[model samples]
Target: MTNDMKLNKLLLTLSVGALSFIQACRSPESDEKLKSTIQAALETTPGIEVNVEEGNVTLDGQIGSDSLKQNIEDKTKMAGGENIKSIHNNIVVNLPEPEDAREKYHEIIGGAVDSTLTRDVNLVLADFPTITAQVKEGIIVATGNLEKSKIDTLKKRLEHIKPKGIDMKGVISR
Candidate 1:
């Protein structure tokens, strides 16, 4: 083959190789951008983790309620766009009470216990009616117009439906 023909063939091969490299590079950059967007959207949600692999996104986390989980999934779908072939949501709803119930007593009780406002033993004791209907994973210190019978009853109920780890103290009904 002539030297000029051989030179032309070499240049063509190099051009094709470079084009392939650029295309390959573009894919990963796009995937990274998608991953970043997904992470940003999920930042406010607690107990959730986001990961992207080969253009597929997976969301794993614990949501406070079932409705919140659905909201997260819908938002994720909107963010994925055309490049995202599939999404796997493994979100867990940590609602303590049954769905059909008018009120989630456990969640309400847990929230109150977890709140800084109810951390005071005196405040919790004075608010018996407000707190009695709730269930929490914490120590209960009773004080004030609470009767021993009432206190014992509350303690028994708490023990019966004890949440993972909780301790009761000074549960004396006044």
Candidate 2:
């Protein structure tokens, strides 16, 4: 081939190569596509929040279980593919609240203890109509006029009901 023709062909090839390389470089559009893909993948998952910027994906908010977290991460990777630069998982695993003794008593003892406690409390406070009693935090709090003898009797009866203790601070006539 002629020297001038060869030179022109080489220049054209180099120009095309440079243009392709520039086009292949990361852009805002690519990042947006990755974000869209991740959002679409996690659309059904509740409480999971996602943020994407410059091909970096950030996952945040709460999840119920560790298995769920793993599943979500795997799905995110599948959706994001090689275009994802990095993944920042800041998701928190939330546990359920523990059951309290009072709640268990209510569930198990139910009307049996409730009725007996009411009857016994009424018997103890029959003379003092102004006095009121309630069960709070596993303790029986009696308010208004009270006597030590009545308190002892109430405590003896309440032992059957399995209370933690009797709160006598509300009783004025101790």
Candidate 3:
């Protein structure tokens, strides 16, 4: 083929490929598809409701904390992809009534505690890499190796959170 013919053919092929790419990158044509996609993303979480209208997404649910509610909104956005224009996170954080927290003693934990409490305990110990804490029925059990002074500090801090009791028996003081 002539050089001119070859260049024209290349340009035509390039134009077709670019058009195909654009079509694939386009968002879902219907709101229902977008809603279903978001629903699948948030399936693990219960009490959540998803609604979509003209690219606007409304999320309603009851969650334990603000962080969790924000997480749901973010996950919905990721699932909806370009199809979601806006998100209305109307998730209510159902805070429980204040507890008496009259924890007198530490109880032996046979297994993992509630996920939220475990997460909170982990966050509290983020600075102390050597320490790990667990809770069972409001009792906290800490095990790790650290300086004696730091252990004292940790005990005070853990007490601030008011876990029924702090068990550092497994903790080794240096």
Candidate 4:
């Protein structure tokens, strides 16, 4: 091939290679920024734990109340930028359940929901309750109706049991 033709091909290949490199390099900085923002949000909210994997931020741990959980998410979104792939709100608020404490808290919460009192609260616990109670990796799921005043009372009552985890999916009174 002519030298000029060879030179042109080499430049084109180099340009493509450089473009690919730049695109690949972009995500790490974005990921780091996301991580820092999530970390800050977690720090602001008591009992919130955040883990970032492949640009997805998973929040785990118990906040005192559901309002706190929502607030954490809002703040994280504001700080982390719109590029964040997912924000897993796996946070659980502590609550009571009946069963072996070692078993998953979700099971216990499930049992509680099945009990007579659950209907009175006007709440339906989903098959896999959205409320997950976790502490140091252990987990329990609690889902039911919750009046604002009753939530504090329920939390206090559950604290006495002290299971490995608690998930309180208490719906606010309509």
- Show where candidate 1 strays beyond 4 Å: 1-26, 96-174
Runs of candidate 2 with Cα error greater than 4 angstroms are 1-25, 98-174
lDDT of 2 by residue, 54-78 (tens): 7788999875445556667878999
As a whole number from 0 to 100, the lDDT of residue 110 in candidate 4 is 34
Clashes of each: 3, 0, 0, 8
Q: Model 3 shows how many backbone clashes?
A: 0
- How would you encode candidate 4's per-residue C-alpha lDDT over 48-106 as one tens digit per residue? 67766656878888744344457678878887776676789898965424333223333
Steric clash pairs (candidate 3) = none
Give the lDDT ranking, best first. Answer: 3, 2, 1, 4
Compared to the true structure, candidate 2 yields what TM-score?
A: 0.42
TM-score of structure candidate 3: 0.46
Candidate 2 vs candidate 3: the TM-score winner is 3
Largest lDDT belongs to which candidate? 3
Better of 1 and 4 by lDDT: 1
> Which order, best to worst by TM-score?
3, 2, 1, 4
Task: Tell me each candidate's RMSD, in Å, in order.
Answer: 11.8, 16.0, 9.4, 12.9
Q: What does candidate 3's lDDT look like per residue over 103-170, in tens digits?
A: 21112111222444566677779989999877876678999899988988888877766565678898
lDDT of 3 at 39: 90
Cα lDDT of model 1 by residue, 1-174, tens digit: 999999999999999999977754547677788888877776655567877776788889775555567767777777777757678988886644323221332342234333322223333345366333222344443333466567666555544433343344533346
Cα lDDT of candidate 1 equals 0.57
